[model samples]
Target chain A: MALFLVNVLDGFVTGLLLFMLCSGLTLIFSMMGVLNFAHASFYMLGAYFAYQISLVTGFWAGLLIAPLIVGVIGALIERYGLRRVHKYGHVPELIFTFGLALLIEETVQFFWGKSQLPFSEPAALDFAAFAIAGNAFPAYKVFMIAVAMGIFLTLLYILTKTRIGMTIQAALSYPETVQNLGHNVPLVFMCVFGVGTAMAGLAGVIAGPVLGVFPGMALQLGSIVFVTIVIGGLGSLWGALVASLIIGWLQTFATAYDITAEQVLTAIGFTKPELIWDHPLQDLWTLTLPQLGPILPYLLMIIVLVLRPQGLMGNRES
Target chain B: MNKFNLMMATALAAGLAAGAAVAQEKVRIAFIDPLSGPFATTGTQGLAIYRHSVKELVNEPGALLDGQAEFEMVPFDNKISAKESLIQLQVAMDQGIRIIAQGASSGVANALTEAVAKHNRRNPDDPVIFLNHSAVDPALTNDKCQFWHFRFDANADIKMDALTDDIAANPDIKKVYVIGQDYSFGKAVAAAAQRFLKEKRPDIEIVGNELHPIGKVKDFTPYARKIVGSGADAVITGNWGGDMVGLGKAVMGAGFDKPIYTYYGATSGITAAFGEEGDGIVKLVGAGQVNPAPTPEAQEFIEAFYVSFPDLDFGQPQMANVAPMLAAAINEVGNATDIKAIAYALEGMEYDSIVTGKTVMRESDHQAIQTVTVQGQTPEAAFEYDKSGRGMVAETVVELASNDAPTTCEMKRP
Candidate 1:
């Protein structure tokens, strides 16, 4: 039971981490109508930057400084790259970002090589938190959860309460109308893009140690963030939250169980024929969600898309 | 016209004709694999090895090039998808490629096999031969075996059959729990291990078996808990890459305190991930601690690999083991640059390798029969070892079946 609780906490922590990436993605998609495929690339950049910065000025400085650098880089891309490609339409913008994503991944490979970086947990939190049912939950996990949760709450407050947040939200509804109302709509878009990318950078800062800042990590997790937003609802922040949490829990819970597809088939009276019993797929049926957790978001997104195109709490149609 | 002017014009025309023929007759061999995307790292390594083997084959002093002796290697990206591989195969054939090499995963390999077979049935004379080097699925040799396809890598059954004898000898290990990646290679290794273990020691029990997805697994605490609580004396796993590292970290961090037996665990990358914690993890593969040192040819390849990649630690790289095997296979193909001759040459061929004394590819299943090495981490720091992490204080080479197990393949020899 204690193990179960630890897993739940782990799931929640992972979910918030997903939220940090997804929140930025959905907001960017909502405002610009183009899914920034390179958002995860920026996250990867943040992790690498943090690693570099941490080597010089410890984890705390990296935690504070890396995301700002990522935010600035993101704003530059929005202003120059995405803005230039925007003239050709949203599809071209999406394509441009996709190209950007691939470039970023290649650049990362060129910089770091094809090996996992030795990103260690902070020295301060380098111990087990609790031993439950003879398993020690590491303190680093709890710290990650706390920081991710803090970031989420802080971002939520800033989005809902601040003047800048109100303007950005209005710009999302009516970009030209807001411009007519004497507000710089382009600047708002740029800022929102910057903030969204910054959130992903924040996720990288925390997730780097655990995820092991690697070259392919951005490509691995980039599509999942899209899945999270799509499953949550295209432009709904609350939907992203639900989807991310659900995905996190689903992955944690799925891997925890030991069940096989053959069992289900056998229960349904499909006994294995000795001739075909030795087939490779006989073992494939044993796979669970945790086994496929990385792709589960896409599966969920597909299911959600088929059933509810608007998403769980989404008002806008995909 | 004058006799002198006519002779000069004829010679110039003949020279121009020969040059055109040389350019047109160049055989294009398509190299399809996941060249981009997440799994491209492995694909890239495979490509590098392929290039090195080809360079060795072509640049060999007495190597023959047959009638035309010219070729172009055109590589296409399959993105690790079976369907995509099939499409790539079709496109490659459409682009006038009569042969291809690659299959980073079994799914792609199997799909390409079917696609190539379908192409053969439709066009008998213009056949495409696929040389698969990386996909280690046993079923590819068994149920899904194709006449046009030939595998170079040691199959899952060969690897498991090798490890079973050593495991059977260890009476201390009575209970075994299997944990593997949720994929064809992983499942095949686990199932093969289970079958062989049951065959040798009927009394030994498989306590619990679990399959986790590849690349998706992060925190393996729950999986580790299950394995630890199962009271298994030893655990066998077939996980690799980030999943392998993550699982090891989880097992160590959660204090799963059991010796982990693995097919690919004692990997160089695993050492990087777990550091000294990776000590005592046992891995089963063809090449480990290439003792008796290596042949002059093998030493040349090893030295070249190191010189090319100085940043990478030359310790337990799986590529170092697999690359030499691949090179030997290419060598045996013998002046056969096209797929058909290469396939025929590879089947039922034996070669003296640095690691394995006499590795043979069985005629019946086209599966490579070779020795397997059991590697354990050395406690003594700065221990001497071979490239595959064997020859240390604690390492053993175990022999398994000398041929591929009875397969249901009806591949008629051409």
Candidate 2:
């Protein structure tokens, strides 16, 4: 039971971190009608920027300034690069972002080199906030949870309660109508893209210390972020949150348990085959839950895609 | 004008002939490893170490026999894929490079060994010799051994033997957990750990054994929780690179204060990532001591290497021996072209390694036998790694004689 609780907390932390990335991605996709392939790269830039800034001005200053820098760069890319490619259609936009991702990764490697940076959690949050089952959950994880929740609530408030949020949503489906009302639709799109990328950057700033900042970090989490947004519903923030948490719990619980196919087979009254090592189904018999932990998210995504083309909370079909 | 043209043609002809002569005296070794992708750091570091080693051990005056031959490493990025490695091997061979050196992945190593073996059988007149520096899968030197391939690093089974011996001496470590990347080398390490521990310390119980995907895991906290829940007193893993660093962080973060035994706990940004947090908790079994140099000459060599590449420590001690040993074989045969003669010369060869003392190339399996040391991170270490202020200090030394494991290789000589 104690172990289960630890898994829950760990899973929550993992889920929130995913949400931090997915939230921005979903917003960009919804507002621009173009899926940004380089969203995770923005997150990576956040970490690297924070690392550099932290070296000079400390972690707090990096946390604030790094995301703003990312936001500015993102706005520039939207204005110059993505805006030009937008006329050619979604495929071109995707191709542009994809190329941008590779370029950013190379640029990062050029600057930081291909090694794990010694970026660690600040000394202030070094101690364990609490312990369960003899396991200490660091205060840094709690901070991550708080930041993610704050972003979620603030995003929810802006989207539902604010006039600018309503205008942004109005522009999403009826850009002509919103532009006729004297609102700069192109500028809105650029700002939304910038803000979306800045959120990803914020995720990276907090995650870099925990994940061990490196050049390959974006690649590691890139596919998974897509999976989360896809499974949650392409443009649904709520879907992103639910799917992220589901993935987090699924992976953590799968790893925590040692359930094997052999046990399941035995429970169903199947006898163990003699010389099982030579059997055709030997691999199946030896397969364990933990071994499948990393692939569980993809498996879930496949199941969701097959059953419901639209995500659980998403209104539109992907 | 006609006289000037004739003089230029003669000069060009003479220069071409001299260039051909110099090229003949140069032996080029194709370094097939990942130069891009996530594992690029390890590969790049290995290449740098090899280049530096050649500069000091083979290129320096009186290093090789008569200094008649110069060794060069021509790099071909395999992208850490077996298929790509095979392609690189073909490209290297096409360039008339006879010697192949690689060691980042055992899967890649296995592919190259098979490819080299087939290439040798089909093209005996033009064969390639593989020089493995750091891939430690036991099968490469055991059932899957090839006469054309040579391993400089100790195999997984031997390192496990040394590790298990250290664990056996510690009475407090009764319950142990084994985790590794789900691959040939990782499986070999886990299997060896289980077998060696059972043989040496029968009373110890293996509480948990798990295999996670190599380089795919983003968070190891769940795995760490499992270990903590398993009630294991100690943990053993053969993880390296980012995986090692991630595991170390998760384990330490989870508050499992017990010692974690590893095959590669130090170097490659791992030591730096762990920093003061891993001091006294993380331990590694490897070839030679790093903090306190094995010999005075090795100390000088390490110091010089640091001066050249300040960010990198002299991590792979086996790399220091690769060029010198290859040069010895080349000089003995008086030529680098005869692959068979060089193979025979390298067989049963004994050389004094500045880093690991006396080392022997075992004739039966073409595996190098050298002293192994079990070290732990400490601030008292003579040399700090990655500016971490903590370095690996040797806690125990297992000499070359006792560090031998029986090989199942059946040599098929040409």
Worst 10 residues of 1 chain B by lDDT: B385-394
Q: Model 1: which docking level applies?
A: acceptable
Which structure among the candidates has the greatest TM-score? 2
lDDT minimum window of 10 residues, candidate 2 chain B: B397-406
lDDT tens per residue, model 2, B1-414: 999999999999999999987853677889999998778878888888898899988887556657777888899999999999999999998899989999998999999999999999999988889999988888898899989999998888888888888999999999999999998878888889999999999999999888998889999999998888888999999998888888989999988888999998887778888888999999998887776888888888888888888877777888878999999998889877888899999999999999877889999999999988888899898777777888999898887834357889998999
lDDT per prediction? 0.71, 0.90
What tens-digit string does per-residue lDDT give for candidate 2 at A1-318?
Answer: 888899999999999999999999999999988888899999999999999999998999999999999999999999999999999999999899999999999999988888888888888999999999688999999999999999999999999899999999899889999999999999999999999999999999999878888888999999999999989998899999999999989988998899999999999999889999999989999999988888989988999998987887889843
User: What is the DockQ (computed on Cα atoms) for candidate 2?
Assistant: 0.73
Ten residues in sequence with the least summed lDDT for candidate 2 chain A: A309-318
TM-scores of all candidate predictions against the true structure: 0.75, 0.95
Q: After superposition, how far is residue B122 of candidate 2 from its true place, in Å?
A: 2.4
Location of the lowest summed lDDT over 10 successive residues in candidate 1 chain A: A282-291
Chain A TM-scores for all candidates read 0.93, 0.98
How well is each residue in B1-414 modelled by candidate 1, as lDDT tens digits? 699899999999999999887653454568888877655656666566555544544333323343234335688999988888878888987887777777577888888888887887787667787767657787887888877777766677766766666678888888988888876777787788889898999888999776776776655766776776667877777776677767777776666655676665543345555555556654445443432333566556546655665443333322333334433444566443444556676677775555454667677877666555656655442322223233222256654344636887777655
Task: List clashing residue pairs in candidate 2.
Answer: none
